[model samples]
Target chain A: MRRDVFQAIADPTRRAIIGLIAIQAMTPNALAEYFDTTRQAVSKHLQILTECEIVRQEQTGREIYYHFNPGKMKEVADFVEPFRQLWEKRFDQLDHVLRKIKTTKK
Target chain B: MRRDVFQAIADPTRRAIIGLIAIQAMTPNALAEYFDTTRQAVSKHLQILTECEIVRQEQTGREIYYHFNPGKMKEVADFVEPFRQLWEKRFDQLDHVLRKIKTTKK
Candidate 1:
């Protein structure tokens, strides 16, 4: 299967992992403590994240710390940025319609 | 599989579909013309997007037009907005470090 940042963040657990590691790096064992799953499952998710380069692993002694690569997340952010304007426009239109309805009611 | 905005936009083709429909509503047949896929394939992608409420279908006579629902994408935007600060901080730190390296070289 192809691994990309989009696929990396598609899972809720992986998003949780990103939220945690974005603050600080963690080993699979440490990350697993926060989830209701096994350490192995956490590791599997980390593996996918690493494959997509969303997280990078660094070996310090026997433990591998997974660090969130903010650069990869920039791609996801960039993808969503353009849509922000579209949504805001829709919201603005809705607000206008609501204001018109309010004037009619008055 | 659970359909969410993230999963809906994971595929490149689906992202393309969103971009095109954002400008103007299009039927699956019209959308397929932009891609190298059959109308049914485009409809399958549209199905996932519709399930996630990222796109809505309006039937005008025999043709069904898919309109991009910008509201669903706001969820995606909200998810990535917090991380924007993190990446910006990292970029700033990188710029600072680069300036220091340049000073040392000089």
Candidate 2:
């Protein structure tokens, strides 16, 4: 999958929005109250997040309730797994090299 | 750190460049040759990646070799940890809920 989800989360405001939804579902206006930005700006970010499927918005009575979509975030975690493994392997090698140097010093 | 590293990786070409360097270091011309874009375009992407510290380029003899900077990648991994943990927790909850439903059905 493309890294659009990760890119969608690159913005601090978007990340904050995710954090908010992760805790509880809220309407756009409710979310806007927590941020310094206007509701339209928050709505724009929320739209991008929704496009990326990071957040799902549902109509609850008259208001739209935005909540965290764990499924989309799972995609991000899966995408990062390979890179994470690569880093871990590199770190292991570095650790081995350091240990060898320490043994030589001893 | 901000998600600039994550945003830096949002581009497919940049991701491809990182994959190329991950295997072995290469010159800008050589890296550009693997892609469909111009050398200048590749250079621009490289500059952004450098700004995010995702890749490092160094002068070796007369050629500038672009290599995978594992250090910068470590930062990206660290940045994603909390998000990853949050997803894992959510998944665990989902799994738990599913198991409970299954048991109730049984």
The iRMS of the candidates, in order, is: 7.9, 7.6
Residue by residue across B1-106, what tens digits does model 2's lDDT show?
A: 4437767767778877876776677888899998898999999888888888778889999988887775666655554444554566665555454444334321
Q: Which whole-number lDDT from 0 to 100 does residue A93 have in model 1?
A: 53
Model 1 lDDT tens row, B1-106: 8888888888989988887787678999999998898999999999999999999999999999999888998887767766665677774555454444334321
Whole-model lDDT values for every prediction: 0.81, 0.71
Model 1 misplaced stretches (Cα beyond 4 Å): A91-106, B91-106
Candidate 2, A1-104: lDDT as tens digits: 44377678678788778766765788999999988989999999898988888888899799999978766766555545455545667755554544443343
Which pairs of residues have clashing backbones in candidate 1? none
Q: Which model scores highest in DockQ?
A: 1
Q: Provide a comma-separated list of chain B TM-scores, one per candidate.
A: 0.83, 0.70
Docking class of 2: incorrect
